[model samples]
Target chain A: MDCLRCAYCNICPIYRIEGWESVSPRGKIQLLDKKLSNRLVKDFYKCTVCGLCEVVCQSKLELTRIWEENRAKLVKSKKYMPAHKKIADAVLLYGNPYAAEQEARVLLNSPSNVLYFAGCMANFKVKNIAECTVKVLKLLGLEFKVAGKSEVCCGSTMLRTGFIDVAEKLFLKNVKNWQKMNVEKIITSCPGCYRTIKSNYPKIAEKKKIDFNFEVVHITQFLERELKKLDLKLGTVTYHDPCHLGRHSKVYEEPRNILKKIGYKIIEMERNRDFSICCGAGGGLRAQFPEISEKITLERILEAESTGAETLVTSCPFCVYQFSKVSRLKVRDVVEEVYSSMREVELKI
Target chain B: MYEFPNVRVEVDPEVCKLYRFDLLKVPKPFSAFIRTPLAVFQPENVKDLLEILKFAKKRNLPLIPRGAATSAYGGVVPLKRSLIVDMNRMKNFEVENGKLIAESGAVWFEIERKINKKGYALRVYPTSALVSTVGGWIAQNGYGIGSLAYGSIAENVEWLEVVDFEGLKKVSGDELKFYVGAYGTTGIIVKACVKLRKNNPLGVEAFETSIDKAVEKIDNAYHAAYKNAEKKIFLLAREDGESNDLGLKAWKERFFPLTGYKSTFSNFSEVIVPIESVVDFLSEVEKISKHYQVNFARGEATILIILQSRNILKALKIIKIAEKYNGRPFGTGIFFKRKDKDFWDFKKKIDPKDLLNPKKLKGNLILNFAGLIAWIA
Candidate 1:
């Protein structure tokens, strides 16, 4: 709450587009400080929850958490956007925010020590990410279970949009399912899902007096270790850090390492790693404010294109989907890059 | 409520409240006097600014021109219930002919980054440059990070396009003194063209020395400032790899003065003392509070003293001590109005109606009594 009112509004993706202080991180904090929940609910939700403000913050305010907790408070006050309400409703109704049929879920029901949580986005929206991830895992000789139909939403969108109670329910369900399956480790391609299960789930579980033993990780973290760097040239490509993975989970170098190991010369966008520009698909922004989200996505896409890299590679499926929508440049998940590299080596043989 | 079809205007109580204050945290006891702005307006261009001025003239409402609101001088704080002209949306800049021509709301760091790509750098920028706006630095005290070598922003500025009640006109040379660091009382700075230098990589070094010796070491360096009250000099020069990790850390942290100390104190005051008097001035500051810092410039040291326990008395005592050393509080915004008579004359000439950022460059009852309160205490 000790916002110095420095107004570092330029760094914010939402504020950069909206050009309003009310939508900036500092302004939202001030609004919350003043207890203007009615105004805070609308303005705060405009954010993509990218921790750029935190990265540039002199105060080092944990601004993403502040936004989330404030959104939770606003939700308790029954003051939230209808879009956020729709997300809560969908998560409750379909066990996932996408409202996809249980039959459409690609469940690898085999018993294994590892569970590949494809998240809601990979399962429904971008199915190739999950399929490629499965192929990559199989190629690496790892026996893992994909929580397809049985998988509950990791409660990332729910937590971000301030449906913590609903998110907790889903989290508990998923944790219980993984525990029953004797899952020791969970890996996911979705940064949102990875961050939630790896970071938020344990915290929430502790608060609720529930315990689950599973090592959660993003696919990049898993692939960077398991997938050996083959002798192949994959050409130059730029990496876009998913906000949930880079700033939220601190999984920056793993993705870059994975890319470098796959034989692609990484031409970094000017804003890369912790300082990376968000892909504008996280924190329920793409689901709620598609136009602003797309504009932000376009900004990142422009930055990526400026690098002159042939492909825009990222680990998050949401980033892939969002960038694919507006970006003319090629977008691929890091797993897809690895899968392509593996296939290319096979073709060479 | 003020309105322009192209401009964004907000009268929401919550939004206005956010614009009501700046970096200055007026304690609860005295904060009641600071009024929430009637409205906040974001004008995107010069045309919108003129329209807002015309509307303000008609309404007889004073417009507080605000940049990043990084200054703690109450320059952007609306003393009387008035409209806030948020200048951030007008951010547009270009580097041409070895100068950066920028809208007043363009961030200093952003402009520096833009020019750095073109192998040009700002002559002087506030240490708060990361968040401070060009107009904010120009409007308030602009002697900061690079001022050790380049002097104040006044010396570096080529011209400023200002819009007062009269009309739009470019002011430079002696006229800039009336507007630059006048806290927007003279006129609203729409755009400015400032001098730039070659973007040379600066190396930093830490020196443990006396106050005067450290100030002496700052001669012709890119930047030299006291890292803390411990008299450790964090000096930046044109040389390569002349610093340790602490010096590099200090160099990196120049933009983050408000970081890591948000809860340390309730309020702070910026004071400027002659280079000769820094030793005495700092000694006096040490007597009162250990939470103070000094940034050395060409011939002066800008000192920031955290007021102990949010005590107005202690803050006033520090100001009185600074005056003894022939120093004055930085920026004449609602607090220190002793200097800058030319600003008063210019305000009378340009904004006789005082429609542009009123209640600054002058004091209210509470501020006027600060000295007396200090003396009595």
Candidate 2:
């Protein structure tokens, strides 16, 4: 391993706050070394696996993969962090991290070609993107069923943050639910939900006898396919690229094109696309380390401010919810584009 | 000299974009002090300084002098081959009858802002010209975007004043047409007087035309009107990229007359092309863009053109003709013009020292070494 002589972590915000190697890249690397070199069972599952170091590192090393590789090694050694184990167990028992899984369900009973998988965010936050997406679908004149809160956690949050056994159990449970619904395609807005259902499920389902023949789509890809009708209108706004939605999944332009069509003047922030700043609400920080997470959220807000934007818009409900926590600026999900048409306005000049 | 451990040293590690923050990279030893000599020597005033060059000569200690950290191309940094004598601390500015006098250390932003608020303009201005000290701009023969009309730094400068490392004195005026943008090849620019405009000229912009027609119209129209309305006009074309549909383009068109002006690039990306090959390159782009679905006047390829004259109508006519030639026009803008001053330093050769940044970009020479200075080994 190459040595970082600057040792930026000497003053790394997260490492300083936490005071642990597991939270720092250098420490994480050392832990990985011990787990790989020494035969001891390292508790590798506790990390939030946030890519903050990747954001700050001058060398631009991929630190998240370091977290994942160590997790895989811990799995081999049969070691786990308590918090992740509890989360994995909860997801296995209930279909989501939340206890209200069954009550969150609302099946798509209508004749629809598209299944709107609202994921955990909309299940709890509901109105942010859910209602707006349905309105947009109706405007496009395409048939879509609101899985209303009915869709089980695509089991994405469980798979990530290292709860492998529980994640595997969730994969088995959700596959049966998906099959029962005659699901052909699953479209979700959450990056965590999108990535988990799209990438992680296939890995776990490889040995299952469940012959689920369907495709998983993020709402962004789905929206790009239906942008002609989104002819929804808009004004000047900055789009926040969520970490899961951006650096993780590499989906950048679909939403910008959508905003453009709706007549909104898109004000691009300086750090955009792959280099997008994090909302600080992801990778378990929201629950495990609330203060640090909020700092990241504010940091993203500061980035939006640099653009002199009139509004902050994003595709994920998580971003919408996190952004709303700030009283300083205006924030919205793509759903607001739909909700606006229902209102009438007269400027008092 | 005390023996020391090995370490790479470079002067001017920070590349200035006129912004306060710096982009620094440690490189070979000489790069650091090649331009900013005062960084090492915390000496007293200039009373004792002329004695040093002679003293250094006896001991063979090479001397390097530099202006403010304002050279656009890293021109003001000291050479590692010698001792540095940074001249930023020297301040000498005089104002009279719309004319301003400056020492080597005087900066553009301070003077321009002061003159601008008072409704006046400088004699010469480069893009980075404002940030650079008077001595630095003159020595480098700097060029600004108003290049076509002003014809680079050499054309705008009116006079010069210099002091060689050996205390030699040289003075020139606009009548002689001395070296500018020459990067201090001459002596140190101690004090120089520059020409100034009676009116304040701050930068303002508006959209005009879209395509080659934009260029053609602006060029022809400006020339057509120049007889009666000769005014200095500054123009820059860009690649703003194709809007998704007619409405977006139409919106842009509504804002600026889209018929003559078009764009083919995104906002804020740079276009610094070789001059001799530009016209031919523009012509080829004009013909081939049709198949690529670039219907806008300024798609994929755009050019920057500056027109100068006192007549404003000359500029308007050029805009009209630019419209006829298929240009996606934005709008017109106003800028305060600063007349060029004689750069006494570019003419006098101190030395062309190699000051290299340690972290070089792709395909760059990391070691730009020179043989003048006795460095700490």
User: Which is the leading candidate under TM-score?
Assistant: 1
Q: Pick the DockQ winner.
A: 1
Q: Which digits, one per residue and each the tens of the lDDT, describe model 2 over residues A1-349?
A: 2323122321233543333233445445444455232212332332345454555443345767666665755655656545556656666566666666467554456665467777777766755576666666666666767655445666655555555666667677667766766778877868788877777777667766556566988877876776654343455889988777777777888878777766678888756785566676665556555677677678778878767878998888888888889737688877666446433221211
Q: Which stretches of candidate 2 lie over 4 Å from their true place?
A: A1-27, A35-62, A72-86, A111-113, A146-150, A207-212, A229-233, A342-349, B1-377
Model 1 TM-score, 2 decimals: 0.94
Cα RMSD, each candidate: 2.5, 15.9
TM-score of each: 0.94, 0.46
TM-score of 2: 0.46
Instruction: Give model 1 RMSD, 1 decimal.
Output: 2.5
Predictions' DockQ, in order = 0.56, 0.02
Which stretches of model 1 miss by more than 4 angstroms?
A33-40, B1-3, B206-213, B229-233, B239-244, B261-263
The local lDDT score (0 to 100) that residue B333 gets in candidate 1 is 74
Q: Rate the local accuracy (lDDT) of all candidates.
A: 0.80, 0.49
Residue B236's lDDT within candidate 2 is: 29
Tens-place lDDT digits, model 1, residues B1-377:
42577878988877788787777777676688888888888888888888888898988998899988877778888878888888888889998788899998888887887788789988789877876788888888578877777788888889999997777888877777787788888778999999998987777877666666776676667777774543454555543446677677778777766544424555677788988998888886877776556777778878887654767778778878888999888766777663556667767888888777777767667866866888677
